[model samples]
Target: MAKVRALDPSKTASSLDTPTDLKPDGVAAVSKALNALLADTFALYLKTKNFHWHVSGPHFRDYHLLLDEQADQIFSTTDDIAERVRKIGGTTLRSIGQIASLQRVVDNNAEFVPPVEMLRELMNDNKAFTANLRKAHELCDKHDDVATASLIENWIDATERRTWFLFEASRAGDNSGH
Candidate 1:
């Protein structure tokens, strides 16, 4: 196996010189919020994909498909977020360790978790993610970064929908024979 090299954060300061009309402080604040959002997104994406792959039960197909779709949606936002950071004259996350350090979402690495438990966990996570997005949106509004705020608004709606679906899926009812 080839030896892996660690990323040097200092060497990757390309966004430092990028010009933007926004105040530097505002840019910095929004960038920080976006980084946190990106980190949580990355963590959630991994967790969702893990559940997608590991889910095994009577509702395996439904659970797997839902997770897969949600993971894709989460992964898709990462690029837009990173680019927005750069667009606003701020640097973005550079490594997995950086992302892990900034992330607020908890990772679930258990070999086995009940389907209901998984759904409940993801539902809660999605809700938490929406909260983070709202906080970021507020920062954007404070800074008058309308572009970032708009993006965050869309993300908030998407996350809320995901949470609703997970909540409904996790409900114990006659259909589930629970």
Candidate 2:
């Protein structure tokens, strides 16, 4: 097996290592914020996956594929968020129960919604997720955690793009006159 190269100790912030450079209370606050954002993103990913599986209508094929791709992106981002939390001396809560109890985003019933409605719901979800990520980025900025903030900015930009695409799709049908 190939040996895994470890991240540079100076750059690899361990969940176990106390942040001696910052006030302890500041570290704890940032950790709490990151955990909340991570769980929320996880919940949004599940909702996206559900929509991908159940969406049906005139645009069913395209919407389904898009949702699947978006869900995969969200899943990948969730992993990054969780790992960053762990790197910042905080636990990444992974259990379903933990995510369910801590997630700020609410789950949607994807099976019953119309295709256009699903797009709307997903857009709303992404907007909410973006808002939360922005808040987390602000908190990270307060603590001088530029690494985590940069990661979050990437996620936020991706989510905004996804949301805009979804909303545009929803509007496309309206402009066509039946």
In terms of TM-score, the best-performing candidate is 1
The collision pairs in model 2 are: 15-89
Q: After superposition, which runs of candidate 2 have C-alpha atoms over 4 Å from their true positions?
A: 1-15, 18-20, 176-178
- Runs of candidate 1 exceeding 4 Å displacement: 1-16, 172-178
Score every model by TM-score.
0.88, 0.84
Quote model 2's TM-score. 0.84
Can you write out model 1's per-residue Cα lDDT over 1-178, one digit (the tens) per residue?
A: 2222233467774436676667879988999999999999999999999888888888888888998999999999999999999888889999999999999999998999888788899999999999889999999999889999998999999999999988888874226644
Q: What is the C-alpha lDDT of each candidate?
A: 0.88, 0.80
lDDT of 2 at 113: 81
